[model samples]
Target: MAVYTEPTDEELATLLNAWGLDGLRNFKGIAEGIQNSNFLIEVRQGRFILTIYEKSVVLDDLPFYLGLTETAANAGLPAARPIRTQDGEMVQMIRGKPTSLCTFLDGVSSQHPPSSQTRAAGAALAQLHLALADYPQKRPNDLGPHNWSELWAGRAAHSEDLEPGIAPSIDQDLKEFAANWPRDLPRGIIHADLFPDNVLFLGDRVNGLIDFYFACEDFLAYDLAVMLNAWCFEANGREFDLVKGRALIMGYETVRPLSQSERNALPLLARGAALRFFLTRLVDWVTPMDGALVRKKDPRDYAARLAFHRNARSAADYGAPE
Candidate 1:
């Protein structure tokens, strides 16, 4: 969702030829996310997205990512399907980087989503989980709790510079999570980072879910927890919106209800989710890529979310039905 590599006209022509597409009308670099170099291209066949894998996406993992997305799309989900080249390979090379082309999904991503849209997003997420229940392929959550400490190592002073005395609390969170992270919850493929910008909406319905780069095998309820921290938060990231929270959970239940164990473990899972985002954002904040056309998200936002989650007592605190 960023553009570090700019493909030249000849390269674009070669790519289009490889894909058997012609009449390239327009092309432009997308400059939103931090992971990959993305471009929007319109050809004779149709509009499409071209993603050049950057450092964060491992080259070997492309199959899992692309295949999972293809599975979701095949199941009638609004996921962008990866377009194979004329040789039937899902990936190609551009400037020595692993590159891909996917069908362009049609909808606009919301910046400040309403409760109705949040509700739809929740339902879409559940639908995704159900769609991939027997997906067989598994990619471990590389950014899960086990890796947080490594990501958090030696950045306490830098964290303090952003917000005074916040790093100690983050450390405490890590300890608490280590002692009590959930073990026996129902696990499945999860869109681990389904933030507002990742979901596209038309009216109150979810039209598409993009950015499956962070997708992995994890607790199904943990996916909901990620959404809670993402969609139900106020703009300032300090206050939780109860109405939106209730709507989101209720919407998700319409597709797939949470088990009792999942319900019981929500608060801890939420704290862990918030911590995961905070730590990653902290890392990116402290040491940004030199030439990437990407935005360095504020780690303090998730720091605020972590504070809220620390005080949450149970599932009801997140507007889950009792």
Candidate 2:
């Protein structure tokens, strides 16, 4: 449960009315995202996801993300398009924070090994890369791992009120890695967070991708690396279906093939991706934010995942797809 913002049902309905999107028959908070207070709102036989942006959201960059989704939607990709108010503004100030409504995306989130849904999720992610390839909009890539680590690491190290288990050394390690990780590779719009929770599936197919707040401009390979961290691994700290990796890469390659150089960079890229999540999780552990209703993700969990990458010889080292 992410609590980036909290609004009562009455407050939400009032906000909807203020924006001319009223007539809400029902609504409830969505329990998945950790960055915003989200809800699935119902009205006129349709559903929508409403978010009240929190202090964490960069107000000026809101247009870049919201605009990306709108452009990606035009490109035939599955992502939420921010609906405009009657006045035609994409984002409106609500309750002193940025708030907006999106057409409720269809499908459920994949939690573990992807069950029967990995291939389609893989294919759709590729499609997303293809769709956003030509959109002319550009913004700084602000949500990569290094920034995530820096966001919490500073507060964690300075906090003396947190639990003893929260180690501050992760901040140093993450900073070192960020300073030295490889750059100079293929760059494009990366969906910086494509975890199972962020990807939605219908039946055996991927129907939508959510959580664009972390989206940015980075190496396309880095996007694939994020998928390998979230989709291709197991919960008990082991590698399972490696084809999830193949399906994802193959699907993306169908639209844009990886150069030999890109392929060679993936292992190191995956290590960088792994360390990114580990560092963020560790920072949150040391300095949990006050009034945050969301459950803090375990940084140690990713630290353990990093160990698996340490042993990875190649994507093939995990076993090929059937």
Candidate 3:
């Protein structure tokens, strides 16, 4: 349902021909994403994912994303490699929009992943962090704490309409995060959006991580916090699953151990992660894209998550060993 642009057979053949790929057998619009128009392209050569940048994605940041994924793939990470055309361009114009082709990864995304899968996801994330440790390119997190206030501007009334007391809660969260946002945490490239749908699994292991569109440089622990909010919680987003959280943390630490400072900051970072998702979802809910084949995720789900994070005083609350 995320296909906003429909490419014709002729167009497909022309595009593939430019890349020196033979015979476009078939292609179909992929429905799993909300931010971009995607198609699963099958040709005489191989399978690839063709992504057309939507209005939401900034055109200038495409290189950083493409480069990061390419770097991760080159470093032996299970990431989809961006394919270059005969002209050596990884990105090209198609259908009057910036588009790119990436080698298709084989796996399925799970909505209700088991704890073992959660552990694998954590390990995968840590592996991603390590893989990008020496990556020279840097893109600042556009949705980091500094930008949250701007995103919340003029949305108080909309928040109130969604739920009576929600506006005040959000305002308080904004103030708290701004005041307590950690400044000295270790920084690196992070998949700022690592939700369940962005990760693919083959049996119990992670097959690949996709959607580098939101990759950025930020606090490394904050990335783990985002994963915890994403993978360790129940589907309803109201309850935390301690066992899953423990497994995930253990798996991550096996690759990259958290410093004491990072451990101390996890609760606050988790709260910020919940708020980031909540604000984005709230904005989407209030001003949805017209005629877009995308589902509007309920903002209240992250609202419930925000409430839980507020009361979590330490990493121990998230099943971290004391």
Candidate 4:
């Protein structure tokens, strides 16, 4: 979360008044993520996070995101629960932007997670999928395979500029994913962006999962694919660490075993996951927002990952059991 819109003390006070929270001790902008403006808010009762939604998040989709986290939290998942206003509204508006207050979860994000931590993350993610198995609400994966072409449109040169011959490789990967994307895998709510920054860890345990803005109904294995790219890869974003990948998949399977079909489709799913992030990052690099307090991630990181996944023939390539 980044500070794109700066709200004053009086404005914050008025907003907190609606929630019956008084005496704002302190508030500070969080500069970790790229999508929303987040602030750590302290009041008489306790600490909370005030998130101001920025661009790319549809205002209409707020309820689904909030409900997903609420459901997950209620089901005993370590997820941040939404705080409702006195009027029972989970979403509010501040400075003409959609906003909400979420209970602060205690833990720190690990930038370079060890194998043990990855194992816990994998188990936690599987537990999250199980918790949302019967979630009544459903939201489409807006950034799924079908939307990649549009996101990649007009960005070929940008890819080539970053590295020669990368554009054609990306184009070929997109076509292959479109033609071979899985159809009948287990489907449910997925935390599409389950990167380390989005998960809080207290030692070896996963304290909480945050930033459900990208959560949507999609292939369950696809979430694992996202994690493979997110947690199993080294910090340099070049090589995929087999040891870490094995620990993560084993931990996940302990909670929810993968079917043979899911295992067979994992390599393709991993490629798709890498492509999704690469395309989005490329777009952001090409057409960046001016004066926005957001960091444009290096798309080349995902590009290197995509190149690696291209040669992967099975889940074993990611250190999963054959």
The list of candidate 2 runs beyond 4 A from truth reads 2-22, 143-181, 291-293, 318-322
Clashing pairs in 3: 1-31
Model 4, range 1-322, lDDT digits (tens) per residue? 4477888878888889988898789899988556688899999989999989887688899999999999999999899899999999998898789998989999999988999999999999999999999999889998999999999888888789997899888788887887888899999999999999988999998998998888999999999999999999986579999999999999999999999999999999999999999998888888857756556789989989998999999999999986
**Backbone clashes under 3 angstroms, per model:** 0, 1, 1, 1
Cα-lDDT of candidate 1: 0.89
Give the alpha-carbon lDDT of every model: 0.89, 0.71, 0.88, 0.90
Candidate whose TM-score is highest: 3
Worst 10 residues of 4 by lDDT: 287-296
When sorted by lDDT, best at the front, the candidate numbers are 4, 1, 3, 2
3 or 4, greater by lDDT: 4
Candidate order (TM-score):
3, 1, 4, 2
RMSD each, Å: 1.8, 4.3, 1.6, 1.8
- Candidate 4 lDDT score at position 192: 96
Q: Compute each candidate's TM-score over C-alphas.
A: 0.94, 0.82, 0.95, 0.94
Which of candidates 2 and 3 reaches a greater TM-score? 3
Task: State, as a TM-score between 0 and 1, how close model 4 is to the true structure.
Answer: 0.94
- The digit string of per-residue lDDT tens for model 1 on 258-298 reads 88888889889999999888888898887857756456789
In candidate 3, what are the lDDT values of residues 10-74, reduced to their tens digit? 87777787778986787889885676889998888899999988887777888899989999999
